[model samples]
Target: MYICAFMLILGLAFYFGWSAAYSAWTDMGVYAVSIMLICFGAFGTWTYYNIDKENKANAK
Candidate 1:
């Protein structure tokens, strides 16, 4: 749940970053933030799934 919230925030950050970058058409900072958000979100989602799987296994 916490990871999901983090991912949601990152997704919003990416949206805002991309919007800012698009408006300016050349802001490297926004691109960098977007990239970081993508990477972090992906890693976090993967970790969440792995942990969920482990919990299910333990329950079984």
Candidate 2:
């Protein structure tokens, strides 16, 4: 469940970042938001993967 949520956030973040880069860069607020989203998504995805790995290792 947490993994799914992070994945969704990551996906959306990429989409927004991409859009902002191509067209919305002129808007500082939108650009900043996109950048923040991308950073959050990356961190969340990385953290979740590590947690999942730990869980699997302990289960084995």
Candidate 3:
């Protein structure tokens, strides 16, 4: 569950950032994408950590 969430978050970040970076639109838009990457990246990392911990505890 957490892994899925993590993947989703990362996917969103990449999608947004890539699109913005490649786009010839305003610079502010690209900066917004960068912010999204940072925010989503953090959520993904923390969620994965919790998921791993839960799985390991269950295995023992």
Estimate the lDDT of model 2: 0.68
Writing each residue's lDDT as its tens digit, candidate 3 over 1-60 gives: 556566556656666666767874445655566556656666777777898999999999
lDDT of 1 by residue, 1-60 (tens): 567558658866776767776785456776667667666777777888899999999998
lDDT by candidate, in order shown: 0.73, 0.68, 0.67
True lDDT of residue 30, candidate 3:
56
TM per candidate: 0.58, 0.55, 0.48
> Of the pair 1 and 3, which is ahead by TM-score?
1
Per-prediction CA RMSD (Å):
3.1, 4.2, 4.8
Instruction: Give the best candidate by TM-score.
Output: 1
The reply for model 3, stretches above 4 Å from the true place, is 1-30
Model 2: worst 10 consecutive residues (lDDT sum): 1-10
**Location of the lowest summed lDDT over 10 successive residues in candidate 1:** 24-33
Q: Which residue pairs does candidate 1 place in steric collision? A: none
Residues 1-60, candidate 2: write the lDDT tens digits: 466566557666766766666875466665566566666667776777899999999999
